[model samples]
Target: MYMPWPLPDENWFADTSRQPEPDHEDLRLEALVAQRLSIDWTTRRQQITVAVQNRVVILAGVVSNANARQVAADLAYDVPGVFDICNTLRLSGPRRSHR
Candidate 1:
């Protein structure tokens, strides 16, 4: 068998395990959520604050009823990559539970 006289050696210890992390995805998601909640549904628009940290969403605002609370939670849950959501959204009206 014949081989090259001056062939270079192949790489055997190259580092290929480190991956770059995303920087602003969480901040963008939080801002989008807040904007969606602040939109006016009926005659006048209400203000709702949304804060997201490490895929956990926290909602704080004056909701109309339990339905509103549920909707808020659902909205946050629908977002992709959500781990645990903290629903602190308070309702403005009275409380009524089906169960």
Candidate 2:
């Protein structure tokens, strides 16, 4: 009589002993936020720095004006996994009046 092969145990493919890396999610969120900011026209993407921790995004760097700063925050918020935005962008100077 021919016999069929036995199947492996449920844990055969999985290494349950290892814990998930915590920084992976943070890094992914950071990249997403950064990409969003980079493509936007309102904010100075090159001057901005993006950081993520526990799903919270921190925007740090120099922006042209208050509107740019707010735009950065809004862009970050558009990311799917972003929990909060810490906008620390500083304005270069007051806007000059155009004649």
The predictions' CA RMSDs to the true structure, in order, are 14.7, 16.2
Taking the tens digit of each residue's C-alpha lDDT, what string does model 1 give over 11-57?
Answer: 44656686455337678778766655555352024335777777788
TM-score of each: 0.57, 0.69
Clashes of 1: 0
Please identify model 1 stretches exceeding 4 Å from their true place.
1-23, 38-44, 94-99
Which residue runs does candidate 2 get wrong by more than 4 Å? 1-22, 44-46, 94-99
lDDT of 2 by residue, 24-87 (tens): 8899999888888888888644489998878989888898778888989998998887889898
| Candidate 1 TM-score, true structure as reference | 0.57
Q: Give every collision pair in model 2.
A: none
Looking at candidate 2, the ten consecutive residues that score lowest on lDDT are 4-13
Summed backbone clashes in each candidate are: 0, 0
